[model samples]
Target: MTAGTGLIPVHKTDNINKLKSLFPALVHYGNSDMLPMHMPGHKRRADFMGGIGKYDITEIDGFDDLHHPGGILKEAMAAAADLYESDVTYFLVNGSTCGILAAIAAVTKPREKILIVRNCHKAVINAVTLRELDPVYVYPKKCGSLGVTGSVDPEEIRQALAKEKDIRAVVMTSPTYEGVASDIAAIAVLAHNRGIPLIVDAAHGAHFRFGADFPAAALDCGADLVVESLHKTLPSLTQTALLHVKSTLVDDGEVAHQLQIFQSSSPSYLLLASITQCLALMAQDGAKMMATYSENLCSLRQALDRLATVTLLRQETGFFDYDPGKIVFGVEGYGGRDIAALLQSDFHVETEMAAPRYLLAMTSVCDTKETLLRFQTALSRLCHGLPPRKAVSFPNMETVAAEKVMTPAAVRERTWAKRDFRESSHCVAAENLYLYPPGTPLVVAGERISPEIITAIQAYVEMGFMVHGVNDRQLFVVSENMSG
Candidate 1:
């Protein structure tokens, strides 16, 4: 008999005996005659929303509690730790956001300095604000043509550590949304030498362990604390994430304690079961799955490489490495938005993100050759149809590096007013403004807004890209009287 009873079909016969996760237990409990008097009001009613309600359960007897796990849940996390080779692992149902918040809070005291990459996700900024930590910025090398931030240089981390004596932790994102990975091993060494814990937001790198073609996982790269979004690159339910502790420099107990404060009390069993099923499948058949996936990706890349105008981003000079799964393509004459629109309207294909210079097509292990072929076909047609290459006006991305005037924590609580972006030059921004797909803030709160920022925002908006934190051409700026 086969184990999987969910949406994903498991065909590998070898996985029959190897499957070890909480998912089968959930199915058994769901099938049992046991009546429910638990917190979930659904009460195992399969008719509520298909058969999903049957598996959606609360922390019942053998299922174990997520917060104070001692039984099945604990073992499940341990299996994940063993798979990822981490000393300790915790399942995060609240997504990587909660993990980032907890990891930052656990490591440093209030107002303690931490070095953070400028191109880090918004969650990193939120963690700094929540923990009231002082953040010193380290910027990533830029891919000049694409206008996208690439790898964080190890030299930058070394220089920052030498300069900031009080820095307790170093935080960065590897395998950026566009799949640009940094040299995590070298960065980890620099931080460990200073006795500072290295925390990596590897949200897009959950699948790195499965394939040799992918860049190295941060857990294997000597990071003290690493957070991965299983749902991002792996076959798991949305919001499923994992936090791993690798070194003695980090207190695993404190991370567990912080998770208690940040993670949800009533964790969704359906999501946990999804995580279990994902882990089990990967444990059993991951090598085969990745092999097939890599083959398909390679074929698509070969086809894409033949296109004259559209350029596929593979290996570049600045980043340590690149993930082949992220299919980023762009032409000099046409904006990413232009190509994205054509893909949607003409080909009925949707991409992950449309940047000013490139459109991102995110692929996972689930992407079949047929689907990839369809995308390749669409892109090739679009490439042939696009007008001859000519320069198009794009944002001057260098202006995004705004100067910080106040701490994020201080500015977050201050009174604020919405002002026009055009006249808000030199004003302290009260809210995070960023492009949604890649949520690196253009201007975090406390940063003095530059005219170039205003210009960039307008250009992004004009190019048919969504710029968050703008309310009908207005931006939230700290009120004059609230200035410290």
Candidate 2:
């Protein structure tokens, strides 16, 4: 009767009370067909846990270990670090990319240099090429003519820690993923006035500190590692993540030994019981469900600001805050994947990323208002008779040339090939390309691919946008590397 007891005895102030769920072992093997020899080749069936493989589990005996969580997964990560205030919290079943590779390998070491924040998140450049560190970029400030990407200029992180020298940490990407919010309490006082340590990917801000209409949660604006992604906007489950540790200038036992060396020594007690039932439903009803999801996202941004060919991109996108559950529409003459494929073919509505001039969506508390009034009656019946589009400005994708020439540990000791980079150039790049709903790279594998990074991968392959590190249009570079 133990594996997290509760067969129904809730309300310790219910919002999923008394934090149970430490592997309900697929809810005690659901209607017990009891057929498991185990070692998950998904024998829990229901066709691969679609019905939740009878609580998809493993670490048996009273279900403890998530790399040392004691009982009830350290009381559901200390009630999700007291509902995200954080001094510690770490669950992350490999989502915020193994908590940004264990918060950039528990704060820099290898070649130590840090400071990133230019459109970040390709798991912070694969945690600066697996902690070989030395990055230094910080840019992001676009938002005008809304080609998005904003925030991060705490005096360019106090002039890159006063002209970079022995700098050790810093990384940004707050509400971004189209919600943009930086100035985490003035870049955590310019990296604790140079004792460095910022680390904030805040994975699309796991519902930004519950809410004051979003933007504050980077461990209450003084980051020292963050990484969220509770299924990107809560209601968890789907690579549920957390990883917090708010400062002590990051050393929570080397972020639990770099989350036991980048998580998954088999840890997904059903994604840690969906991140402890999304922090007990964000501590029993997250602020009246984030103030009724910011009053149905400010009445769906005043009905998408009276349509007239749509434009919404709110909170004056220069960011210091902006996450009205990340809306971002902008459609004049359409092309955010043709208005997300005309609302996924006449209103199945799906959206949450599209850019080449907007589309994003999001909203939470598991959204409803009759599916946002059937998406405001199919976006005002697909902007009625169309043809208005005159606003153009949303394409900048910052930071392209910070001059590397080498050291991503000498571009992974070269040797590569590939070619046809649209009639090549000063080649050197061997890969790190870009464009997968902002994977943000544009040449970063020992860089030098110039011709303005082959015209930004030929304008994201002539805007049909695909570009993820060469294959057709080839371009891998580094063949016996002569010299750029």
Candidate 3:
């Protein structure tokens, strides 16, 4: 992430057009590109979509099946595997949720333990609940400036593995939502030495494989199972993702079996086709495309660096490593959401996500140089002669600890009852409480919530932050009448 006048400038060319020949699904729609009257119920109105309803297909004769891919779908998956350098890669229309769930279920059984970085997405929590797994949580190093979370410490994983016995798997999110990347190579070695597969939720890292300017993909770093959601950082349609199997520790057959159960029986052909076309574009044009993207990002960062009261997060900020594609900027005094609203209402630019301390702008290869410049220009105008808001920082949440009363699966079966928020302390939780953006849980199912945890939850609520799992100032806890 370069700054100052050293920003690499992108040279745009008008003749550059999207490669039209790569889309097989679009080709399957036949000559009439306007041919409609399909099953999607859009009724083939060109004005409704430009004939997108024609592309929304199911597993028809030659289109290929998601559960049993044999023809074009198999070829597409094979191409993706080769491109990603994985032993095998599956096309996931169900997003990274299906991949994470399948990867966890394939490698572990009910009641087994998995060591996971605490900053993982809520999807991991859902998986832990469904599999009834025991979790050993390792918290990340929190950023002190705004109390936001940072990358996982490889040493933390080593210590957790040494202390925990009968561990079936290890899971962590590399290049976290804040763009902090842990030492995947070191973490993978730690898990491999213990004969446990490491599952990396690289959902925000789909564009990582395009260049070394970004952190290396978890698959390239020896992770047994890695999941990437292309929609997050790539040009694919929403819900498109890929699951890569690298090490021999993960059973490929089991991954397939679990995917069959987890994903929809009828997957969307449009998403699959988009994945294929995206892979082809990246495979053929990614090197040049990424170079242009980095150039634009560098220009944006350079302009952003000139702001007096705003700070751009970088490697010198005590992070292990960072992804430049994620622009996490903080104001001297204002909250991130305030800055976000300012941009939205005044500048009409909606950002990806914002925390108390930072607002995230997800730059992609598809963003033009003009868009990047416009963002920088907006910042300059917004910051010029503006007074700083009051300096306010939330407390680091590492101390909000909970005790394990039972496995998440065990908690799922306990007939749940409601209790008022204030009296919920020391009670086993029947639900997970967390905030979005960085969806790591403040509390998960089957844990005994502490007074500190309750205080943090209340404080977040008072701050006007949305805290899931509380229904009208009440929470679900293990019913006292239920059998142990």
Q: lDDT tens string, model 3, 370-480?
A: 998888888778878458676676644554547878877888777999998789989999888888766778888888989898888787777678888887889999987
Tell me the TM-score of each prediction against the true structure. 0.94, 0.35, 0.91
How many residue pairs clash in all the candidates, one count each? Answer: 0, 5, 0
**1-484 in candidate 2: lDDT tens per residue?**
0011101112343223566554454576545666667656666667664755556767766778888877878877876776665778888888988888888878788888887876786778787888777787767767645667777778877887889878788788887787777778788887887787888887877776666666667777778888888897888778888888878777898889988888889886777877877777767777678767777877878887887878777766366667777777777767688888878888788987787777787778788777777887887888885667676654455555556767565677667778898766786776777777758676677767777667766776778777888777787777764544
**For candidate 1, lDDT tens digit of each residue in 6-107?**
122234333234447677788898898998988788787978878668878888888899999898788788777777777888899999999999999999
Question: Which residue ranges in model 2 land beyond 4 Å of their true spot?
Answer: 1-16, 19-76, 80-98, 103-120, 124-130, 133-228, 235-241, 244-278, 282-333, 337-354, 366-371, 388-407, 411-426, 430-437, 447-484
The local distance difference test score of model 1 is 0.85
Worst 10 contiguous positions by lDDT, candidate 1: 1-10
Residue 358, model 1: Cα distance from true site in angstroms: 1.1
- What's the lDDT for residue 364 in model 2? 80
lDDT ranking, high to low: 1, 3, 2
Candidate 2 TM-score, C-alpha based: 0.35
Candidate 1: where is the Cα deviation over 4 Å? 1-19
